[model samples]
Target chain A: MSMLQVSGASKRFGGVIANEKISLEVPEGKIIGLIGPNGSGKTTLFNSIVGYHPLDDGSIRFEGQEISHLRVPEIARLGMLRTFQQTRIYGKMTCVQNMQISKPNRNEGLMSMFDRFPKEDLARIDHLLEFVGLYSKRNLLAGDLSFGQQKLPEFAMALMNEPKLLLLDEPTAGINPTLINGLIDRLKRANEEMGITLLVIEHNMRVIMNLAEHIYCLAHGEMLAEGKPEEIQNDQRVIDAYLGAH
Target chain B: MRNTILLVLGTIIAFAVPFMFPAYQNQFAMLWLMILFALTWDLMGGQMGYNSFGNVVFFGVGMYITAVIQRDLYFDIEEYAHVAGRIDALTPDQYLTGIFLGMGVSGIVTVLVAIILGAGILGLRGHYFAICTLGLTIAAGEIASGIDYIGAGSGIVTPVFPTELMAKGMFFYFVFMVLAVGTFLTNKWMLAGRFGLAVNAIRDDEDKAEAMGIRTKRYKTMAWATSAFFLSMAGGAAGNLFGFIDPINVAFAGATFGVWMVLMAILGGKGTIWGPVIGAAIFHITQELFWTYLFGWQRVALGAMIVGIVVFFPQGIMGFLRQHWPHLFGHKVDEQTTVEQGATKESEA
Candidate 1:
């Protein structure tokens, strides 16, 4: 069974249709790639799948349960989480504190409000911090980190939750070329070692082709083509989307 | 350890001050109230990044509820409304019971109201939320003014404190001091926990916070409700101490008490535990000095102070201190080696 299934998802902003009749599936424990030109509604699909905004039409199922109507937090609790294109760490808080807040439990009750961070969670947090090469700066305010450095903590924060599936939007958008390889390794490690299924939206051909087993290409708010990385690389339609067809 | 010593010393000083002057007991009481105001305001405005201009609505509701509860408890409601605060038949025991019971009920009811208001109003973001809350306060004041049961237009009068108990100022001084301390400790404890982290996350980037599994609206509403709970109790005490509850001026008092709370939080360096406490003290003391020496020009002086705070200390005193002396607040000034090490690690990885 697929970990996540999106069927006939459509979204619009006034006169502009951001996504229309988009269908996709991520089988449990597989890294899937989504590639699209600018304005092809890749981000919009991520937003709708994660319940940032309601889709005008369609259904989303996660682990065999319908989730199109669930809000963001609710969707997150059911083992689906997403990271932003623009890194969004709590700038004023220390990196450790950021990790603590991203723990699985929403802690929605009055009693949970007063909960101290558990000692066990600290060990896991530290491990994740080390995994992302940020243990040395654990106490530093997240905002103080360089733009590339900030993304490391954000990735670690998502890992801290141990979500069944993680949605990464442009995970390597602003990273240095050297760091991109490290991030790709970590993403693969997270999949192989920790069993986190990934759905990544990437513009970098080299990164997505390296990271994703199967790639889906979107153009003009519709699914243009999808296949194995080499097939997608050679697809004439995708080539046309990237470099306008004659 | 040093903090505990300082806190004990501060408590001792707080308890002794009204006794030292005796005459300025009410002024001392107002000082505690101001501290409460700043502390509570920072919970939503500073920690959660929901700047509300209508928190005074909860305060006003608390005042009215307490007064109504007190009046209706012992005496006839119809007769009490007509007499309007002149009747002082209750003994010291009755007075104390009424105050405590009324304030408790006021806190609870106001929290419920806050939750209801927050559910709808907290959905609005940023300035729209702020403006909506301001409208809520103004509308509450106008509605209160129009109601006859609570003394429309003219305002209601709270029962007079029986002198046999103690001087009213000294009584309220202790009461408000306890209230302020409770507010401080409660806020400090809450902010030390997951609640604090969650709210701060919301403040930093609400959309990101939500995507990370925080129910942003829920946390926002909870913070507002907590602020309301404290403000309502303070309002109850204040109404009885002042002996009047003019809907616009005293109960709601959006133009003065409402504005002052926000200013005090901003002036002290919001988003820190000690910031609001320090801010309230400085702002209150400065206002008192201006009121005494500046005479009729006090408002003008206050206006100037507000401008000065905005211009020179936009981040407030704590923020200024944090910026200048990071070590004092436990922030380490990192050596250049760390950044270099980070770059090396990136390349190596």
Candidate 2:
């Protein structure tokens, strides 16, 4: 069964239609890639899905519940988490501190946060830091990390809540190639080992092509194509919209 | 470790100084309370990055309520006479508890007012929020002045209990210590928790904090309420110490004093935990020495000091200390090497 389903979703900013009639679905444990050129409503669609921007029309269902109009934090608490394209790690805090914020719990009280976590969860946090290659730098301020390293913490923070479905926006926008490769590998491992679902929006063709099991191409606030990576690469509309094909 | 020892020593001296010195020393002790009040201002203004100019509103409410209960209503000679005749000898300490109780009541009332006002004004950013709070302070002062039950502008005159002078002094001392510890703990909580991280992120960039799933408005309101609670308690304690209260001291001058507190916060180091305390101590000492010695030119001296601090030490005394003596006082300076490198890379990219 699909972990997330979007149907006839639309958003308007003033007079401009940032997203119009956009729909997609992601099965549990699958890696789905969302691609589009600049001004193609990729970020807007992500924002709409994450509840940052209110949908003007249609609905989004996460785990079979309508979440189109929920507040951002409320949506996040319900096991749907998103990372910004630009790094949003807390600069003053350590990387471990950032990850601790993402850990999910039924208790929202201050006393609960102060209560010691179970041994296994503590290990999971440490393991995730190691997974992101930031275990050594856990004590350092997140602002101290390199751009690629910073991106790793953003991913780590989103996973802290142990969300079943993750949305990543431009996960490799400004990182070096080596770090990008590491991110791709870790993301794949997370999907495979944890059985988590992912919807990623990216401009980097190499990262997207390697990671996505299914691909959706958007342009001019509309879906241009949806299929396997090979089919998307072959589609004339996608090639023209994304790569400005000859 | 050495810095921690120094802090402990400083606290001991603060507690002991009032007793060892003459009655005039109590004036200096009063100044320390002012410094504590200023530190509370910094908790909201500097550390939280909200520029508030109306902290005096809470302070004024604290004073007025304390005065009414201690002088005009409960502790008044006539009221006490009735109780004294009915109940056997009530000690002065028991009577002063009435005053402390008044302070607690006023503190709570001020918290409620602050929460409501904060809910509306704390959501505003920059100068708009500052100006709105300032307006509220002025309006509250005006309204308080007209309330005759609290003695109006004539103010309430607390009866002098010569036998209870020692008790009153100790009471103020205890009050000051409680407020100082409360302020420190609250500030520590804010700086150490996830909430503190969210606040810092919002200070750096509000939109970014929102995108990261932080409820910025809720955090701001909580900061404001917390600030108001402590600020009012300090004000109430000040009223009890003075043994009299008027609108000028409780409200009007309090508003101006709030500005001074903000200045001290900035001069100490805006976001650093101990920065405000350092700033408040230095500012209060200088203000006291100058006002005591320089007389009429004290304001001029204060203005000059503000100018000097702004021009010479833009990051304030804590920033200056961090730059020049990272290891001087035995405190570990947080090296921003990573942040510096990240900024450089961003610029290069």
Candidate 3:
């Protein structure tokens, strides 16, 4: 059964059709890759699924409940989150504080946030910071981290939420080639060890081919192809539409 | 341990000031009230990263509400305000009852107003939010002056304390001092928890905070409402002390108290626990000195001082200290080396 389902989803932006009747599925505890050329509506579909804006038409379901009409934070509270291509982190905050603040406060009362933060949670924050190999720099301001290092904190921040599904937009973008393997390793561990379902929009062909079991290709606001990673790597039309552009 | 000592010493000095400078109760009280203004302003400006110019809306609303409630309790406010504050009305009992009840009502009303206004206005980002709030403050005074019942162009006089009450200045001075302490502690408590982190996140990046599962709108509204809640009580205290509520002069003086709040907070290190306090003290003390010695030319010199501070010390006093003595603020000098390298890499990206 799918953990997330999007069917007939459509979004338009002032005479521009960003996503038109696009549909996809994210199966539980598996890694899925979304590949497309620039302006091919991959990000737009992710935005619609995560409730960044109101979709003009169609349905999105998480655990089989319609969520297309909900706002971003509400959708996040239901255990779905997305990361940006241009990383969004509190640059002025310490890395661990970022983790603590990202812990889902959906049910935390107004006053409960003021109480002493639990000791176990603090331990968990440290564990996640170390998971991202950022334990040494945890005390430094996030603004003081290199671009690639910043993404690690952002990754750890999303992990702190313990979201069942995470949509990563270009997670491997802007990192050195040497660090790409480490990120891929962490992504797989997050899926296999931690039971997170991922639907990633990746521009890196090699990273996606290595990381994904199933892949969906989007081109010009439509799902161009859906298949196993091996099948997608050999598709003729996908080669002409997206891979050629890359 | 150092913070604890400073806290104790600060409290002792605050309590002792009225008695030590017995003749200057009014000035001492004003100092405490100004601290309230600066601290509340910092909640949005420093913590939340919404530089608002209209927080005085709460102060004015609280003043009017308290005055209207007090007068309506014993006499019709319309007639009294028109009489140009010459009434010998309201026995001490009625006056006290009205003042307390008004304050209680003002607290609730101000919170409601804040939530509604914030829900509407806080949605605007950056400069629009600042200018919109500024409009709210200036418009409030103009609108209040036009209303006949609350005093129209004429101003309402607050219930004068019965002459039997002793040490008017000292009593109000201590009252404001207690209020200032309460505001400071509440802010400190908030900063020690997720509230502080969440707000700083908003300041740093609102879009990212929302993506992290924080209900950004709710946090923004709550921050503003929190500022409104305490500010209303401080307004209540200040209103009674002022004994008059001219729409422009006392209630909504955007040029004075309204502007002072933001200026004072910025003059200290914004976005830190002790920044506003340090800033308020320096601003109040310096302005007072300027007012005394500069005389007629004070505004001219004060304007230059403001310009100088903004241009040279935009980070404020605490920011300056943090840069030079980071260890005192729990930072290692080695981190600067890492930070500079990261900044260069970031710019290249």
lDDT of candidate 3 over B268-345, digit per residue (tens): 988888788888888888888899999998898878878887888888888888767766765532332243454466
Q: Report the Cα interface RMSD of each model, rounded to 1 decimal.
A: 3.5, 6.5, 4.5
Tell me the tens digit of each residue's lDDT in model 2 across A181-230: 98899999989887779999989988999999999989989988999999
Quote each prediction's TM-score. 0.95, 0.85, 0.93
- The DockQ leader among the candidates is 1
- DockQ, prediction 2: 0.14
For model 2, the superposed segments whose C-alpha errors exceed 4 Å read A113-125, A243-246, B1-12, B75-95, B125-128, B146-148, B151-164, B167-171, B189-219, B243-249, B252-255, B320-349
Candidate 2 per-residue C-alpha lDDT over B68-90 given as tens digits, one digit per residue, 9 for 90 to 100: 66554445545743543332233
Candidate 1, residue B85: how far the Cα is off, in Å = 5.9
Q: Pick the candidate with the highest lDDT.
A: 1
What does chain B score (TM) in every candidate? 0.93, 0.82, 0.90
lDDT of 1 by residue, B206-278 (tens): 8888788876776787789889999999999999999988999999899999999999999999898989998
For candidate 1, write residues A1-246 as lDDT tens digits: 899999999999999999999999999989999998988899999999999899999999999999999999888888899999998899988888999999986446757867899888887887788889887778788898899999999999999887999999999998999999999999999999999999999999999999999999999899999999999999999999998662
Number of the top-ranking candidate, with TM-score as the measure = 1
Give the 10-residue window scoring lowest on summed lDDT in candidate 3 chain B: B331-340
Off by over 4 Å in 1: A106-110, B81-88, B333-349
- Order by TM-score, highest first: 1, 3, 2
Give the chain B TM-score achieved by candidate 1: 0.93
